[model samples]
Target: MANLNPYLSFRTEARQAMEFYQGVLGGDLEITVFSEFPDMVQNPDQSDLVMHAQLTTPDGLVLMASDTPDGMPFEPPQGFSVSLSGNSTQRTQEVWDALADGAAITMPLDTAPWGGTFGMLVDRFGVPWMLQGDSE
Candidate 1:
């Protein structure tokens, strides 16, 4: 089966952001630093930066993230939000609330005209997200 996961890119705080997510969502996070990969540590300054991090939540949410390499640019663009939708209204609401922490709500989570509960927000990390739940 094809799985949909959100892969995040950070300037230099991938580890911190992933840890924050693990805290909010109750997940186990595995982070590998640039120092772990000899080939990537050619630049000694980047050794402590996060090369990659994966968070696997108890509910099976898989989120991957990485920091931009030493010479790369990380520009956060507008106009794209990771959309999460399902039938579990209560659970979805809980997730929406959690993600809304320190975020600006573009749309309040309410019954949508399309017959579902929907909302949009930009998380603290500047990642946009959309949460949806089936109408009960």
Candidate 2:
């Protein structure tokens, strides 16, 4: 079966952001810095920057992120969110609440017209997210 995972790009703070997420979501996080991949590093200063990071929550959520190389343009667009949808409403609410602790919610979690619960928020790292609970 195929899987859907969200990959994020950070200017230079991917490590800190991924660590913060690990705290909130309770996950196993693996991070690799540019120095770990010597072949990918052209600038010595960027060797300490995060080249890639992956977080796998106990609940089976996998999130990946990376820092853009120095001098590279990595602009995240506004008005878009990485969405999470599943069959457990209660579990979905738990994640929603945890994510909203230090973030701004654009839409309160509530029943959607399509017969599920939905909400949208921007996490503390400025990454927007959407949560949805599937219908029975």
- Highest TM-score against the true fold, candidate: 1
Indicate the TM-score of model 2.
0.82
lDDT leader: 2
Q: How many clashes (backbone N, Cα, C below 3 Å) per candidate? A: 0, 0
lDDT of 1 at 14: 90
Score every model by TM-score. 0.85, 0.82
Q: After superposition, how far is residue 81 of candidate 1 from its true place, in Å?
A: 1.5
Q: For residues 26-79, write the lDDT of model 1, one tens digit per residue.
A: 889999998888887757877888888999988798999998876776788476
Candidate 1: residue 24 Cα off by (Å): 3.0
Candidate 1, RMSD to the unseen true structure: 2.0
**Model 1 — TM-score against the truth?**
0.85
Clashing pairs in 2: none
lDDT of 2 by residue, 1-136 (tens): 8998888899888998899888777889999999988999989988989888999999898999999986788886476688888848887788888889888989999999997899999988889989999876
Q: Candidate 2's C-alpha lDDT? A: 0.87
Where does candidate 2 have its weakest 10-residue lDDT segment? 70-79
What are the lDDT scores of the predictions, listed in order?
0.84, 0.87
